[model samples]
Target: MRTRAKICGITRIEDIHSAVNAGADAIGFVFFPPSPRSVTQEQAKELIQHVPAYVQTVGLFVNASLDEIEQILKQAPVDILQFHGDESPEQCQQISSQVGRRWYKAIQVKPELDVINTIKSYQNVGASAVLLDTWHPELKGGTGHSFDWSKFPKLDIPLILAGGLKPDNIEDAIKTTNAYAVDVSGGVESAKGIKDQQLIEQFMQGVQRGSAK
Candidate 1:
């Protein structure tokens, strides 16, 4: 089976075009205020215009209230919601139901975490998928460090392996986990919020090679 890829933290029209041209399945926009890659509703509304059909546009949120999310959705046409905060299963379902959009929950992987149960908790809770990211004390995600892949668990639902993925090791990551998809932001970036076209091309090539094997 071929693995899917999502190019995240898009901030420009050229980057969106580049990601779509490079065959990314999804493009992410950060809505959290604290993130360096965060975009306002106006910016997201404009940027989303460049995203063509079949290529999903994901909105990344961190502990945002229902009203805040609703306010953002009122202007930005996001296809999916990604919760990258300490939101519980109930809270996730509540927000998704209110917004009428499928959602994904990001689990920060740590050695002490019960990987399986934590993933299973989201089952029947309105999460379409689960994204596993490396844990960091200060940051929610987009940390350029990788976690212990050996701790990864197989799941019935889609598992998106993110964190520290780049051209150099993406093939190995795919070969190892056989994850449903991979989410990348900094891996193919020239700097935060800016994507490098050449790196995006290389990352896609790596994904193809890895899936073939």
Candidate 2:
């Protein structure tokens, strides 16, 4: 099967167009205020307006309240919700059910946690997929750091690999983990919150090459 790609942390209209043109299956908009790539509801609404129907739009949140999420969704046309914080399975289910959207939970891969069990836990709680990201105590994600790909466990649910993936290493990541899809932010950026069009294209090419192998 062809490996899918999600180009995340979109902050501008140009970047959105670039990602779409580069064949991104999904585009993510950060709603967490602490993230440098985060956008306002109005900003996300405007950016999402330019996105076509086929490309999925994801909203990234960090332990946001239902009210906050609802308020944002009221304006922005987000297709999926990605929880990237310390939300419990029940909390995730509650929010997703209330919003009536499929959701993904980001699992920060740490040596102490049983990765397989964590994935199963999220799946049991109704997560559509589990996004694997590098662990950092201070930063939830977008750390530009990579975890040990060798440690990934076999999973029934789709694995969306994230953290430190660039055009150079995306092929290696896919081949190693056999991930269903890949999510990239800092990897395709000229700077934090600034995406490079060429990098986006190269990343997609890498995904194609990796899937082919």
Candidate 3:
């Protein structure tokens, strides 16, 4: 019931302030060029300059090369990295070791997904936590498609629920998934990449209201 929240796909400076003001524990910037919310490393760095301490700056990526990841580390001071691609355990471990810190990996869960198997698949990958995100099958996250909540049984690892989570459904998603955290991207946006402050607040409130139960 007690779960943290992360709002991803931040493209504008005002949205960053809005998320922090709304009490989001973390804010994610999309580094994947294909995503509408994508930002350049320089832009990401500038956006993070005024981000207060205690609020994590998470960088989300697809299948990026290690060199590219290194470039990001050199350019931006991110607290966390979120790998949303088909990266192997060895690769994830390598990236964490390279960065001198642990990071999160997203597991694409299809309909009728089994939580146990999904957790095991990533446990050996040295992921700090496993995120249950919708798999578009053709795309890597940011699709706005969600998996069935009934599909997730019980999970043991630190779980962050994602995909199609918005003000209308976030509360129900958290209550049903029993996740340790909830991640929202396209859900609270006015468009593909633009974030709406009112929606962000309402979504966060919905999650809080649901957890109170």
Candidate no. 3 TM-score: 0.94
Q: List the candidate 2 regions with Cα displacement exceeding 4 Å.
A: none
What are the TM-scores, per candidate, against the unseen true structure?
A: 0.98, 0.98, 0.94
For model 2, name the residue pairs that clash. Answer: none
C-alpha local distance difference test of each model? 0.93, 0.94, 0.84
Deviation from native of the Cα of residue 57 in model 1, angstroms:
0.6
- Report residue 193 deviation for candidate 1 (angstroms): 0.7
Task: List the RMSD of every prediction in angstroms.
Answer: 0.7, 0.7, 1.6
* Model 1 root mean square deviation, Cα atoms: 0.7
lDDT of 1 by residue, 3-120 (tens): 9999989999999999999899999999988888999999999999999999999999999999999999999979999999999999999999998999999999987999889998
Candidate 2 accuracy as TM-score: 0.98
- Per residue, candidate 3 scores C-alpha lDDT tens digits across 144-194 of 878888775565678888888889998888788778899998888999878
How many pairs of residues collide in model 2? 0
Residue 174 of model 3 has an lDDT of 79
